[model samples]
Target: MPMHPIEVDDDVYALLQQHARPFVDQENDVLRRLLGLDGSPTAVANRVSGGDLRALIDAKLLAPGDELVHIQTRKGLTHRAVVTADGNIRLPDGSTYAKPSPALKACVGHDINGWGQWIHAQSRESLQSLREALRERQAD
Candidate 1:
């Protein structure tokens, strides 16, 4: 494949950096992942191999397509995201985030603890609590 160069602003570059896997993802890899161009079997396998939410799914704590909700009383806002088959969080607009924090941050416009804030819509349980339960199970 031939490589081409394109220019992006600082913010765009930073966004790519945030989504990148440290030391493992080059710029093209990050771009491919973010752009949903990594749909090949190998790419899907690599993507699903590991992630925070993937662990939860493996433990049966969260199922794929489960909705996670965040309520910001101060801003009078409610945001929703769904867990993808590979454990990524997918917002309604079709953007997928690899981690909870960045997923919530995209909606809230600031840094927040997504594990504590994003509630499982059906169970009304915070992800943090679920994580704790998974931890306890593992420790046994």
Candidate 2:
């Protein structure tokens, strides 16, 4: 097999190292596992629904009842959602969505990166930013 050199910043390199399996000697192997290409095709998406947000709650990345707001730039209406006790998301009108994007679409009437658009009430940052912070902490 041939090897290719890819450039990564310090943070990404740290993330790869943090996720590298202990017994993996090759960088490719480590990267494969980190990327969930080591045989689990649905691993990344599955982990998103289960582990990622759960870990955030466990690590206190977000608190229950934390409001997630999306401001519709065109409509000029602010949509609000709350994180439930069980980590499910509930929209302003009492409708619930398991994922953020749908909830955001329901709120704002458009498709968007809910993770990037939904602002965390406390942190005043996007959910995407918060998730990145959680991943960064794991890397450390």
State which candidate has the highest TM-score. Answer: 1
Deviation in angstroms for 22 in model 2?
57
Name the runs in model 2 displaced over 4 angstroms.
1-52
lDDT of 1 by residue, 1-140 (tens): 89999999999888777877778887788778665577755346436564468888988889998999999899899999998778778776545777789889989999999999999987899999999999999999
Model 1 poorest ten-residue lDDT run: 42-51
Number of the top candidate by lDDT? 1
Residue 2 Cα positional deviation in candidate 2, in Å, after optimal superposition: 66
Pairs that collide in candidate 1 are none
lDDT tens string, model 2, 5-92? Answer: 9888999776666655557445676666544455553344434564234556778988878888877788787888888655557654
lDDT, model 2, position 119: 92
TM-score of each: 0.68, 0.60
lDDT of 2 at 129: 91
Clashes of each: 0, 0
